[model samples]
Target: MTQIPDVAVHHETVVPQAQQDITDGGPDMVQFVDGEGTRLERTPANTPYADIVEALTPEDGRSMYRDLVLVRRLDAEGHALQRQGELGLWPSLLGQEAAQVGAGRAMRSQDFAFPGYREHGVAWCRGIEPEQLLALFRGVDNGGWSPSELNYHLYTIVIGNQMLHATGYAMGMQRDGVVGTGDEERDAAVMAFTGDGGTAQGDFNESLVFAGVANAPLVIFVQNNQWAISEPNYKQFRVPPYQRAQGFGFPGIRVDGNDVLAVYAVTKAALDNARSGQGPTLIEAFTYRLGAHTTSDDPTKYRSAAEVDIWREKDPIKRMRGFLSQKGYADDAFYASVDREADELAVRVRTACQNMPEPSQERMFDEIYVDPHPVVEREKAQFLEYQAGFETEGAR
Candidate 1:
């Protein structure tokens, strides 16, 4: 048997950089605010930041704010439901709201989104109802909405699978003559959302290779939230995630994932580049996950509370709310209204989950094949017969 190198058997060390250069490295990945909630002006590297923020009207700001709040609330509710045994499993997007909402908002109506399972915020921005998200968790359906309807693909549970799908979709868009007509309004692009963990998968690397070769109109948004299950980010790569893009023949950007403004600006620029036939861009949103990997995992066993506390200070919602208040964009009434909306949404989600009807056994076999397959038909019939026999025997 060939022996695999044991990482645990080797000692690891951190590379130290000079503080001044590292500190002044041009806007800390285009951040509008630091982790301490300090606002900074745009530098030459972050020049597009101002334009993207300027593009947002008061209405757009309100919509983004609403998305951030409602999505988080919905996520929290889902976590609770999972703990209560109403949901089979739940993945909390706890500290990564800004990354999802900003990039999601940057997408055009016609642009498609291929998302990992934690993209509830993206789904919300794409017009998916909160109730529909719960269906996946409640064992009611695989997915609730048609991907064609919203241009948002179904949540892909197999990590990095959606990267290939997004790349293929972008290739199709290119073949359909949708790339580089210089019409930003009508041109289509693709945004593939994946996590830090997914970046290690072979499919992700292959997708980037194919995307680079084809010059596909796709934006690979990687949310590097520090921890992939129990493993730390340091274990995944020697350099940062964004730096990997250079090897893939695309411009790579690192962004403060907790900063909504930065995420919006960078993603918008990437999308614009794709629409203009500039090929793929990789954006690594540097953020932290303040929750467990899923409802089933106990993060406490692997991580320290001190690390969580540090990230909580950099909470995206809090930072955004601070900005809103300071800019006089939102008042106490606005906060109250948002809270009420969240409450209403929670009620609706709970009701939907409680009332969702089980799909008929016959319907399960309906969409398996486009053309008739006798073997599958026979098996489905036999399974239904078995189920019917159990019911006839009074087996609940």
Candidate 2:
């Protein structure tokens, strides 16, 4: 039995047996950095992906750092907006910045991505404006952008449903002659984003069966943020996600989710493998969520403050910034510039969110039916009448 870490114990003795190398993501995990922002020496397990990281220029590293900063700022603004009652709810991607940005930046323009509701970082990397995402959370639109235009699907609220949609889309790509075309511009693949908790859902398992059997061009990226809402990884499954992929007849790899360089290298290789018709691959990003699951949640009820503090030491943005600084890829000026941009972005997002026009009251009824229906019309009339009662009483 794998011993679980007991938070009730002293901080020094709180390490889990399964997590002895947690700082470096274990032997089975691909990692590029130690938790303190220092890069790790290449090892046999990570040697396969070393070239991808090696080929990245200093400018590339700086760009990724910039992305990490901006995405985190966008998420912070969203959380603040929810607390101030500006939005109905908001899911903050507080500690998953590196995992999303690295994977997002690795994709080619021709590739498509299907994401869970918390993939704001991926949306940013896909050229999606923060305002568009804010619109959805503001309850102003189903989704503010066109999926076809951006190659990013609408956020899937039903847990693990997008995995099915992604697999079907990947299969469709296979039918369309886009996979293994031997043309960099022509070959395309699909990526599906979900969290560890989603692996328990039937849809997730079913999608894997189809993807593996058909050898579909799909990459299932699971961000194991230590908890699915309030449940920890141990409770979700006896086996980790990456290990389970082998049972489905494909390769699986675990990466240090907080290490952007490692995440980028592994994801790029996986995408390339899929595009080349090598079939599906599962990537488990081992990371932590340092915030509540959502604005409506209170994480302190289930987890310990000591646990949160431990993960805080592994902050993704800080790690990237440290790498850039040590390598002299980015100086003080560049860091300052990114910080200024993040602040400006936060202001812009806040203004746009507050200014979103309230959708027409009749829009609910209009959206429910494409043409016209007697039942919908009757309900709409009754709703409008009921709403007008306050106005009638105010007139007195």
TM-score of each: 0.91, 0.91
> Lowest-scoring 10 consecutive residues by lDDT in candidate 2?
1-10
The segments of candidate 1 whose C-alpha lies over 4 angstroms from its true place after superposition are 1-28
lDDT, residue 129, candidate 2: 93
Q: What would you estimate as the lDDT of candidate 1? A: 0.82
Deviation from truth (RMSD, Å), model 2:
5.8
Top-scoring candidate (lDDT): 2
Which TM-score value belongs to model 1?
0.91
lDDT of candidate 2 over 55-99, digit per residue (tens): 999999999999999999999999999999998899989999999
What candidate 2 gets wrong by more than 4 Å, as runs, is: 1-24, 367-396
- How does residue 241 of candidate 2 score in lDDT? 85
